[model samples]
Target: MIISFVQTKGGTGKSTLALSTAFSNHMNSAFGSVALVELDPQGTLRNWWNERTELGRDTGRVSFHHISSSQKEVFADGIKAIATHNDLIVMDIPGESTGKLHTRFACAVSDLVIIPMRTSTNDEAAFADNLYPIIKEILKVDPGKKGCFYVLPSFTHPKANRDTIMGYFTDILPPHVGCLRTIYPDRSVYENFNREGATLADYAYSVRENKRHSKQALSAAGDVEEIARAITQMLEKEHVSAKKEEATLRG
Candidate 1:
C-alpha cells in the first residue's frame, strides 16, 4: 500500500503523521518493511531518519528516501521499487508549493492520500480552494483508482474551534472521503520525541531522562496508537471491499 501524506498549508504536521504512521505499522508488524519517501523539499523526513540513526534507535523496519521535486519520473520509479520490497510505502509531500503535475502523480499512484489539516479558518479555506480542486482533478483522470482519500483533523484542541472545522469538512467532503475519527491533539511531547530521534514507545524505558519524559512518552504513545487503529481499520475495509467486488464480478 502506498500512502501519501499531504496538505495545502504548512505547519499542519504532515511529516509527523507520515512518521507516526510508519512507526505504528512497524510496531504492529503489519508490513514486512516500510519505506518513507520524502518528496518535500524541506527534507524533514530524511532529517528525522538521520536523527533516529544518530540516537542509535531501531530503524530497521523503516527506510527513508529523499526524492527531489524535479525528478518526477524518479519518484514514480522509486514508488514502484519500494512497493516490491515493502508492504507499506508512505510518501511525505510538500505542503505549500506542490505543482499540478507532482500532485497528480502522487495521487495517481497512492493507495491512500491523506491530507492533515489543523483547525483554523485559513486551513479550511486553503483546503477548500487549493487541495479539493487538485483532488477532484486527479479523480477525474482516474475515477476507478482503488484509492481512499482522507482529510485528517490534526492538532485539534478540545474546543469549539475543532467542531467548527469538523462541520466544514462534513459539508464539503464527499461520502467516499473517509473521516479519520482519531484526532491528534497538539502536544509538546510530540516535538520532544521528534527532536530526541525516537518515538514515544522508544523512550518508554530510557535511562537518561527522568520520570516526566517517560510519562509524556507513554501519553504520546496512547494518542498515536489510537490514530493508528483508525488508519488500520480504514485500510482493512478497503481490502475487504475490493475482494467482495472481485467476487461479485466473477459470480
Candidate 2:
C-alpha cells in the first residue's frame, strides 16, 4: 500500500507527521517492510536521515528514500520500484510552492492521499483555491479515487473536542474528500522531538526523567499511532470493497 502526506501549502506539519507515522508502532506491526519516501527537493527529511546515520541509529523495519526528481515518470518509476520490495510506502510530498506538479503526481499515484490541514480560514481558502481543485480534477478523471483522499486536522489544540473538529471539517470538505477520525494535536514535544534525527520514541526515552515531558511525548506518540491505525483500517475497507466489486462483476 502507498500512503502519502501531501499539502499544497507548507508549514502544516506534514513532514513530521509522515516521519512519525513511518516510525509508529502500529505501522511497523501492520506492514512488514515500510519505506518512507520523500519527494521534496528541499530535502527536509534528507537532513534528518543523515543525522540518524551519523548517530549510528538503526532504521530496523523502516527504510528511508529521497527522490528529488521533478519529472512524473521518474517519480512514479522510483515509487513503483520501492513498492515492489516494501509492504508499505509512506510518502512525504512537498508543498507546491513553485507548482502543483508533485502534489498532482502524488495524489494520482498514492493509494491514500492524506492532506494535513489546519482549522484556520487561510488554510481553508488555500485548499479551495489550490488543493481541492486538483482533487476534483483527479476525481473527474477517475471516480474510483473517491475514497482515496482524506483531510487530517493538524496542530489542533490538545483540549479541543474531537467531534467538533471532525464535524467542522466534514461540513466544509467536498464530497470525495473525507475527514479523518483522528486529529494531530499541537504539543511542545513535537517541536523538539526531531532534533538530531531523533524519533518520538527516542525523545520520550531521553526525557524519561521529566514527568511532564514524558507524558507529552507519550500523548504525541499515541496520536501518531491512532492516525496510522486509521489509515490501515481505511485501506482494509477499500480492499474489501474492491474484492466485492470483483466478485459482483464475476457474478
Candidate 3:
C-alpha cells in the first residue's frame, strides 16, 4: 500500500508521523518491508533515517532507507523503484505551495493520503486556505478515489479545547476523511525522538528497562500505536472498498 503523510504547513509533525508510521509498520512486520520516501527539500526525514542507520550500526538494530528527490519525475521514479521491493511505501512531502502539484500526484497515486494537522487556529486556517484547496483539486482529478484521503489531528495539547477547534472543519473536510480517534499529544518524546534519531517503536525495549522516564515514554508510545492501528484499519477498509468498486464496474 502507498501512504503519503502530508501537510502544506510545516512544523505540524508530518515528517515525524510519516517516519514513525513507517517504522512502526516495519517493526511489526505489518508489511514485509516499508520504504520511506522523503520528498521534502529540507530532508528532515532523510536526515533522521541516516542518523538512525548510523546509530543502528553502532548499536545493532534495523534502520530504514531514505529516498530523496525533489523533481516530480525523479520522485515518481523513486517511488516506483521502492514499491517494487517494499510491501508498504510511506511518503513525506515538502511543506509549501510550490509542491502542491507533486503532493496532489502523490495523493492521486497513493492508496491513502493522511493530512496531519495541529489543533490550533493558525494551523486550521492554513489547512482551510491551502491544504483543503489542494485536496479538492486532487479529488477533482480522482473523484472515484475519494475514500483514500484522511485528516489526522496531530500535536494536540491535552488541555486544548477540542470542540471549539475542530468545530470549524464541520463544513469543510470531505466525507471520505475519517475522524481519527487517536490524537497525538504535544509531548517531549517527539522532540526527543527527533533529536535522538530514534522512534518510539525503536526505543520500546529500552523504555522497559527505565521505569520513571519510560512511564511517559510508554504512554506516548501507546498513543502512537493507537494512531497506527487507526491508520491500518482505514487502509484495510479502503482496500475492501476499492475491490468492491472494481467488481461493480466489471458487472
Candidate 4:
C-alpha cells in the first residue's frame, strides 16, 4: 500500500506525522518492507535521514528515498520502482509553494492521502482554496478514490474530545473526503522528540528517567501507533472489498 502525507499549507505537521507513522510499530509489523519517500525538494526529511545515518541508527524495516523532481513521469517511475520492492510506501509531499504540483501528484497516486489540518480558520480556508480543489479534480477523474483521502486532525489539544474534533471535520469535509477517527495531540514531546534525528521511540527511551517527560513521550508515541493502526485497518478493508468485487464480477 502507498500512503502520502500531503497538505497545501505548511506547518501542519505533515513531515513529522509521515515520519512518525512510518516508524510506528503497527506499520512495521503490518508490512514486510516499508519505504519512506520524500517528495519535497526542500529536504526536511533528507537532512533528518542523513543525521540518522551519521549517528549510525538502525532503520530496521524502513528505507528512505528522496525524489526532488517535479515531473509527473519522474515521480511515477521512481515511486513505481520503490513500490516494486516494498510492501508499503509512505510519502511526505511538499506544500503550496511547489505550485501544488507535488500535492496533486501524491493525491492521484497514493492509495491513501492523509491531510493533516488543525481545527482552525486558516487551515479550513487553505483546504477550501487549495487542497480540496485537487481532491475534487482527482475524484472527478476517478470516483473510486472516494475513501482514499482522509483528514487527520493535527495539533489538537491533548485533552480535547476526539468525537468533537472528528465531528467538526465531518461536518465541513467536502464530498468524497473523510476524516480519521484519531487526532495528533499537541504535546511538548513532539517539538523536542526529533533532536539529533531521534525517532519518537528513541526520544521516549532517552527521557525515561524523567517522569513528566517520559509520560508525554509515551502518550505521543501512543497517538502515532493508533494512527498507524487505523491506516492499516483502512487499507486491509479496502483490499477485502476489492477482492469481493473481483469475485462478484467473475461470478
Relative to the true structure, how large is the alpha-carbon lDDT of every model? 0.74, 0.91, 0.71, 0.91
- In candidate 3, clashing pairs total 0
What is residue 153's positional error in candidate 4, in angstroms?
Answer: 1.0
Ten-residue segment with the worst summed lDDT in candidate 1?
A: 157-166
Every candidate's CA RMSD: 2.8, 1.0, 3.0, 1.2
Clashing pairs in 4: none
Instruction: Give candidate 3's TM-score.
Output: 0.86
State TM-scores per candidate: 0.86, 0.97, 0.86, 0.97
Pitting candidate 1 against candidate 3, the one with the higher lDDT is 1
Clashing pairs in 2: none
lDDT tens digits by residue: candidate 3, 81-144 = 8778878887887777446765766777788888887656787688778777877777777787
TM-score leader? 2
lDDT string for model 2 (54-96, tens) is: 9998787999999987689999899989999999999998886
What local lDDT score does residue 99 receive in model 1, on the 0 to 100 scale?
60
Provide the lowest-lDDT 10-residue window in model 2.
93-102
Candidate 1 lDDT at 213 equals 72
Better of 2 and 3 by TM-score: 2
Higher-ranked by lDDT: 2 or 3: 2
Once fitted onto the true fold, the runs of candidate 2 whose alpha carbons sit more than 4 angstroms away are none
